[model samples]
Target: MSLGTLGRYELIREIARSNDIVYEAWDPQLDRRVALKELRLPDGISDKDKHARKERFKREARAAGRLEHPNIVSIYEVGEENGRSYIVMEYLEGETLRQRMDREGKITPEDAVKIFDQVLDGLAFAHENGVVHRDIKPENIQLLPDGRVVITDFGIARLQFEPSITVDGQIFGTPSYMSPEQVVGRDVDPRTDVWSCGVVLYEMLSGQKPFTGDTVVTISHRILHAEPAEIDGVPWAIAHVVRKAISKDPDDRYSSAKELKAALNDALQGALTDSMGPPSPWGPPLDPYSAQSPYTYGTSQPPGTGAPSPPPPPGGYAPTGASPYGQPYGASFPPNMPMPPFPPGWVNPPKRPLLSPEASEFLLRTLIVVLIGGVLLATAVGTIAWLDRRSQEATAAKVDQALADEIAKVERLIPSDPLAAQQQLTELRRRAQSHATRERIERLLSRAYLERARRLLDAGTTDETLRQAAGLAQRAAEMAGEDGQATLDAGKLLYDIATRTTDPQDRFDRLTEASKALEVAFNSEGQVRSEAGTLLGNTCLQIALLFGDNKARSSLYLNRGIYYAEQVGNRKLADDLRSRL
Candidate 1:
């Protein structure tokens, strides 16, 4: 059926959805096609709610119209016709990220990082301009055929200057990607969008959502209490960044989208610098500055491949039509020019040669000499560079050996007086000349820090002492630097300190850190894996106790505790915890 026109736009056909029909429409004023979304209220909506929905519909236009970033969808106009609100936007030729994910299952880690980087860029700009995209999901992110990603649907975005239309305790957004605070109807900030970005990145790389449940209630519970399983087949740096971005506590997450983007950039430093390999099978070449046209342009050549081909000749083809002269041949001359008569016995002139044979032979001889000279020069330079590199490596190795010896001496002090050992290792780390030496120093430093923190905790449980111990323990975890045994000891120390904290929030934060470190330790076949598992189980129980009112979350944690307990061969402890269930 023909839907007729709204304002200047002629509705061509319904694109998708009902109730709020998005149509492929034509704009007569600009002679361009656009996407028109009409505001259609549900049949049973209240009058006040209807008015609010209308305002919200128009607000999408207002929100997006203010931003002009390349990754943001362009809004043309918002208007009302016959008491119906409609928005006109540039029609993009591409599928949503959701559709792409459904077809491809998952994106390559490299390409996923690229897409994630762009999404964060767009979100960072939106956040800087005081807009929080509360409902960031794959369905709302558009991936153009040119590999250009655009964020759409700002209908639920919270603008800083505007009064929020949301009723208290009302929740908005997809359950799987909502932040812990967002799932519970708490006040949200830029970090809420950061959480969603993390979920999107995880899904893109892992082919699954980090949090999943059959119902919204169950999903929300998981979001609030459950730790996401580590993503497989990705670099530890990348996985670590993802884990931090999706922390259950907003305060523990990156402060803003910009910060998250920076962290991801660091994690992706090498991948971004290396060749992006083949062009993405998901899209065409990325052409952010191409002119708008109904017809798509460019081949599937990857970005940075080379310049585009030149346009066709003036009339769309080279002058291959009838010639002005008698002979049948292509002509560059204009068709309007009169033909001149040729003199009798006239012959076509021979083409002039650029150089005589004698001159060409001389040029070739000189070129041969220059080529030989160039090769000799390159070889000489390379030999010198190789020798210099060798010398530098030798010097570095000697320095590394000296640093390692110093670290060995400090290792003895760690067992007896860790504070003094930490001071020495910290000083030695500054002069460490290689990655291995630095890593060794860090591992020893972690032990020293953990031992010192343990001593402080034993002295007393005052707030000052607890704070000091927690700080030291956190440093230990950080300095452990991927060493499973060191990380386990630091984690166990942190868990011990966390359980003694008086403040519930403080306890929760510390426990989260302790569990994160322990999780990393437990994954490795380290000496303390069993101890790490037992403490991890206990930490889960503590978190469950904190969520006493929410039985779903509590029960979820209880089950996790029992599972971890069994993994460590503590069947009695597992049974005891299971009885609580």
Candidate 2:
């Protein structure tokens, strides 16, 4: 059935539906086929909210469209019509890697590396050009019949030159594939994409996510703390490389996609030979999973399960012929190429089944009766559902208003009654929109804790109080999560605690923490940019002072302190640091 037309494009049949609908379309203007994608916003969202989201989406999509990489899907154009926004992209004739993974189960090591190598090359190019693809997964990667691997979806990629469109402290990503820093809402550079690549590569080898849980919270905690299980059917050499690529600490992993690709090539050399041939067009089919499989969703189902029976979020019964990628299987046409026409007479859909006259008559009567009953029942149900929905919405609105008021109050109170504000924010989480608002609330709470602790220190607190205050400040910094203001506040608190601590070990630890936090503040236009630099430099000086007779080490800190102080026109501090030198 025809969906409708947008601009010069005619959206014909819908191939899939999820958070968005992917439609096979004909671009009459270009005389070519395209895939038209449209977004699906949540119900009850405000027009302003919808508009803002669409605008950002258009901007990002347009930017991604400009990318000229062969392996990236080329968005031919983006447009809005009838209050709906869509992108017309070069359509491919293959299936997603997700479908292949489900169909083939785990892939051969050689095929995995082939796909990984191409992906890494494309990503290396993208990163060099300042694009960081934040969302990379089996679902977003596609495979072609000609043995080409293509990366799709730049929906969440950060164009480094552009300011972030997301709100401060608001997190956006698929939970299972998220990097460790991404999970904690920390500052993400291109290294984040490397971590996600490791995850995709692992899934390609093992047919399972290394880190997963029943809920987002559980999964996030695991990504942050747990080591991935060893991949079966692979040598320790391959596993070792995978483990390093997915290291929880970004500092420990390869610095770039190019670096990762080189390492993968080295690992593949010892264990794999050229005889492996091209990868299977698809992976293992879905069936009753073994007791050993980590993923349990739809595992007990027979092969060729039809559309799945309804289940709770992230769990459901697999239906016949559904692709394991959580959507109907089809290749997203490769980027940078015009799509060939669909097979001749593709418009001919499957015919409807026929019924005998007697059976049709009996079915018609039964359907009429059921239709009458269904209408009556629907009326009653609709009334009940409407009332229930209205009541829930009202309650949610009231709670949201209350939460907003609390946020406002906390912002006001944080300057003076911060301890109370911190307590209030902690309590407000009970009413706050759980994952939707949790990050923002956490950052606010971080500021509250930092403020209260700093006030205590400023008022001449005891040694125990200083220690307690420093701990609070540290938690605050963690919760600040790349927000400039919150980081600066927490950084200042850490610096204060570091300066006052007397013990040898405690001072070193506090100074280390202080230096880290203050560096972030110095990088941003934090309320204490110069102050953060001075404190960070001073922390370094304190560490150097411990070296005692090590003049070279002490001189490094003294020089750094003088440079920072001079940066802000603080001659007095610079001179003092120079004296130390």
- In model 1, how large is the Cα lDDT of residue 424? 95
Candidate 1's C-alpha runs over 4 A off are 270-581
State the lDDT at 516 in candidate 1.
71
List the pairs of residues colliding in candidate 1.
Answer: none
lDDT of 1 by residue, 316-406 (tens): 5434565456555323445554444322222222212234557656755876799899999999999999999889878988988766667
Model 2: how large is the Cα RMSD against the reference? Answer: 26.2
Q: Candidate 2 regions off by >4 Å?
A: 273-581
Candidates' RMSD to native: 26.8, 26.2
TM of each candidate vs. truth? 0.47, 0.48
lDDT of the candidates, in the order given: 0.78, 0.74
Q: Write down the lDDT that model 2 would get.
A: 0.74
lDDT of 1 at 249: 67
Per-residue lDDT over 241-317 for candidate 2, one digit per residue giving the tens place of the 0 to 100 score: 78778887788788999999988888788556632333433233222234323234455544445454333335433
